[model samples]
Target chain A: MKLKEEIINKLQARGVELSDIAEVAYHLQKPYSKDLKLEDCLVAVKHVLEKREVQYTVLTGIALDILVEEEKVEGALAKIIREDEPLYGVDESLALAIANIYGSVGFTSFGYLDKDKMGIMKELDTTKEQVNTFLDDLVAGVASAASAKIAHQNKNKELDEAEIS
Target chain B: MKLKEEIINKLQARGVELSDIAEVAYHLQKPYSKDLKLEDCLVAVKHVLEKREVQYTVLTGIALDILVEEEKVEGALAKIIREDEPLYGVDESLALAIANIYGSVGFTSFGYLDKDKMGIMKELDTTKEQVNTFLDDLVAGVASAASAKIAHQNKNKELDEAEIS
Candidate 1:
């Protein structure tokens, strides 16, 4: 069987770049630590991306978005997705399902990130080039997972400092 | 149309009490402000319950959980749900989707509450009276939404205080 990393890499080769996902991680953690590196965020983002469920969410949402961009899918579904109906929230539902894979931390972070639309997310929402139905939540997942990862790692450091002092 | 509070009261008649829901709200806001009341949290919880999507999620999840408890749903899906399969994270997905109505704050709070199982959540999970398959996430959504609500409210309060100074 192919390794999980190899699987994620193949998916990245398709369209979703790991770097774009990593950029969100950079934004989420930069406020806390100036020394934060993209690689650090990439590690956490990749960890979440490696999950089978996340992979499925990423591919499905992007494919639909791509089809909408190309004007392939037609009729009611396309209209809803393209317009992003306020009440018809299944689009957000699918994206949130992907975000939930990382744990509850993904939920609230996904909410704020969705609202604020920062970094690559900012680009995704603003870009006239493509319909990014899944990109925002996918990016939010990466950012939330990375934030949880950093918080978990820092928790121990904080405990150690407390003991020393 | 029935008022939102009335619709919520109907749900309460089904065994899930508003007071129990409000208790979760209290827990969520208490961390931020000791002076926060159960009524304030109830207002926030009620606001979330007003959403059509949130209402649907709560009802569907609880119904399924109840069906399983009564052995009405006898099949593979029942087995999976009753067992809460490791890979079958959709249950949490539906629950988290409800939580997402508020935003990112729900994510982490839901995670912690799901793990720790404190307050009313603890009772629901451990109850022998009925299977609470969905209550965990539902309650978490209540608490998380309330947390996000208080956080949002507090943000404005903080700004007001800053201006006052």
Candidate 2:
């Protein structure tokens, strides 16, 4: 399958609902523009997912989770990857690293989502399901990137896609 | 002096100009609004400077720089903080941590500034007069935070200073 589809499928397996993620997109975009719809948020997020950085982060996060679960990586690193020790933020940093592709705004968004535990994020944190130490911020990065993309695109009424680069 | 001025003063001591930092702010907000003024960017940055997180980062970046300059912090960390070692991103993480206060938008702004090396950022990168190992991303964080602050404020005409919380 395509990278974006694989990324989404991995997230879905971990319980991240696209609609709920779109809700996050809506929250971010609604503050700036009233015309933004949930669909717009989804479109923006999908576009952000295409960025190589975003794809790398998705795969990295998933791989890290698997490594931790199988006890393949351990010791100090395992403690951080598995338990997500509050002070040892390697996981959060790694997840935010993906978000970093979009910008500092993703830092803020990831910080907020990590703090607020909103929507599906709350579920992903403590389900009897798979370990998702990275899912929360990973999703936050996606939504934040999507939000930035939408804002950038809407900046000009007549500016063509070429201008965005 | 007031907290904002104090933060600026601290950054200034590190060789970052208020004008140069404001240039970073302007680059971030200009795309969103044609009405953005340098003074507006300054005001927004000043407000961001008020945050305890931002204050802490300003001081921390300075401290790290001093540590590097004096050869006070060595080992792997010193390599990362002192030279901003290409892949050793601990320093960048410190800067982005400050940007986290604003939102994902700040991440986007920081990423852009880091990538583009525009305006004062270009100058800050190499002015043999001072050691600026951590200066680049720190400046980006400041600019990005300032940018996010402006965007958050402009989202609603009626959003009072009281509502910023």
Candidate 3:
């Protein structure tokens, strides 16, 4: 399978539906856009998944989670990751790369989702059986990037309309 | 030449010195680490440069700046970039990718430097004769990533010392 497909499959296996993430994006952007559709948010999510940085981040985060689960990760670092240690910021750091592609609005939106723990993020965070240290943040990253993409599109649309007027 | 060497050369041609960036890194990290040396900051800056994401960001940003200067970019987008419009968040977005590799602290540090516009950032921002919309943020990104790297190292060192005790 292609990298994007593989990432999608991996996310699916983790019980995260793209639609759920899209809903988060829709929630974030609906306040700013009156005519926004859920389908538009879903499209934005798909675009975020297509990015090379997002693919790499999802792959890397999932691989690390697996390593922690398999008891392959060694020593102090492993414990930190396994516990989802609050100060161990590497997971969020990786997720930020995904949001960073969208711009400042995307970056801040990721921060919001990360803190608020909305939608799939809440489920991912509360599930103690699995090491979701990275997955939760990655979901937020995708949602925020999609939201930011929509915001940029909306801005452009306004500009075009203004020009026409 | 290697991609890294080419990037360095490109940066040099644009009047950005690695040492100057390292100094920014040193200043950011010094408050947190009493024993930190400028050389250590330089080493961290070098390591940040070695990242594929950072390298790609620097290359892409510089290429866009060149495109803008050459008048190859079209229409409203060109005007936005040429003027370094405050709301043109794409440059900072690209820069954030560089800092995201380090972790949350590095990411926040990049935000700080970006807002404050210290050191070479000031030079790059104010020299209006040339287009440096992206270069300023790129430099800040490099410095912040290096600072975050040192912070991580310091944390590990503290852990080690505690274990030894």
Q: Report lDDT (CA) for all predictions.
A: 0.69, 0.72, 0.84
The lDDT ranking, best first, is 3, 2, 1
lDDT of 1 at B114: 63
Docking class of 1: incorrect
Interface RMSD of each: 8.5, 11.3, 4.7
Q: By TM-score, how accurate is candidate 3?
A: 0.57
* Each model's DockQ score: 0.05, 0.04, 0.13
Per-residue alpha-carbon lDDT of model 1 for B1-165, expressed as tens digits?
565665466456445676777787687568668788888877777788878888778778778887887789977988777865433456667877766666644664565566556667787777777667776778777667766777778767876999999
Choose the strongest candidate by TM-score. 3
| lDDT of residue B91 for candidate 3 | 89
Q: How much is A9 displaced in model 2, in angstroms?
A: 1.8
lDDT of 2 at B61: 71
Lowest lDDT block of 10, candidate 2 chain B: B81-90
> Which scores greater on lDDT, model 1 or model 2?
2
Error of 1 at B99 (Å): 1.5
Best-fitting candidate, scored by DockQ:
3
Task: Give the top-scoring candidate (lDDT).
Answer: 3
TM-score of chain A of 2: 0.85
Q: In candidate 2, what are the lDDT values of residues B1-165, reduced to their tens digit?
A: 876677677777776777788888897788777898999887777777778877877777777777787888868776655555433455567778766576655654565566568877788777766667677778888887888787777765544755876
